[model samples]
Target: MTHILLVDDEPHIIGLLERALRADGLEPVSAEDGESALQLLDERDIALVVLDVGLPGIDGFDVLRRIRAGGSTVPVIMLTARSGTADTVEALDAGASDYVPKPFVVAELLARIRSRLRESAGASTVLTYDGVTLDMLARRATVEGHDIDLSAREFALAEQFLRHPGEVLTRETLLKQVWELDFDPGSNVVDVYVRYLRGKVGASRIATVRGEGYRWEA
Candidate 1:
């Protein structure tokens, strides 16, 4: 599982962010102060960092500096209340991948996180699961060496399932990531796309998790 380091002193914010990250298939490790945040960076193989600038100690800029100086290229997103131009410039200069201000919309923040991850995922243009393959760069799908035709949305849905095989992905998560819809549209779009993907991949390739959502068979 990919781990995300969340550094914030606010308990409420931490709790909220943790749940949000988990729902998106990320494991979040929390630290309330800058020292612990730095410690976590050393202790865990974190895929990314969502850091607060107003930390109790060491501060986020210092932590970001240390991370970059230590030769760690791990992506960092500064999450802070400060929206000043100088503050944003400093965070970016110190090696932050992105910055999100407080009172942020959860969907927007998630979108930024996904965008940063995509930028960092260099040259990863293909995804395969159980002989089903998705060519991300080419926008193509294939099953067992046979080419399969899929719509744009169908390909995105299949790519998500292939990336996280065996993990039960909620309809909400699918809708958010694949369609960029933060709330359910009161429609069966996810199920409809899943059926389209299964037709091209195979019927048994994806498992419906009853009321939960769907899971790509491992």
Candidate 2:
């Protein structure tokens, strides 16, 4: 069975989600705080995570940062009650696979999780850009004979730039397409990920637009 890790403080919310997930044929394990959620990672083979932003003692953003740092590939769906676009964008920029606003339909959440799994399972092996090759299926990258191992985020970013080569992408555009967020002016999360990509893709492959965004130089 596909296991889902649900992290939320509200007992009612957790219960509702757990029952719904089980009804949809998914087994869900849950945690009520960031600390417990982080601990769950070590104990569960969770395929996906439903994370709440208002978590205590680490907050959703901090937990996400830690998750990324730990190199886990579990798809994440962030939950936030706020209607602020910035928060949504920030969640995406921080590496959430998707987001669910408070009061979201359980079916919609299930659909999102299924979609992500399909995409991940269907990921292509090789991605080439201006002679820089990223092999998603292989988990390797080669640029002019120099080969390197890429992390999950690196591969995702490389795919984005390769798909839209030379197109000047604002931080917002990159965040949304690559990270699945709406652009809200000043999130450094995108920039941080771009730097990670630069180190992998060779910094020269990406060009910065002063006072604007960036583009794959190709």
TM-score, one value per model: 0.56, 0.70
> For residues 1-218, could you state the per-residue lDDT of candidate 1 as single tens digits?
88989999999999998999999998999999888888988898888899999999789999888887676668788988876768876876576767788989988988888877776676357888799888764556788989998865787688788878999999999976665545565879888989988888888989999989999998
**Clash count, one per candidate:** 0, 1
Which segments of candidate 2 are over 4 A away from where they belong?
A: 124-142, 145-155, 161-176, 179-218
User: Which candidate's lDDT is highest?
Assistant: 1
Model 1 lDDT on a 0 to 1 scale: 0.83
Q: How good is model 1 by TM-score?
A: 0.56
CA shift at 97, candidate 2, in angstroms?
0.7
RMSD of each: 12.4, 5.2
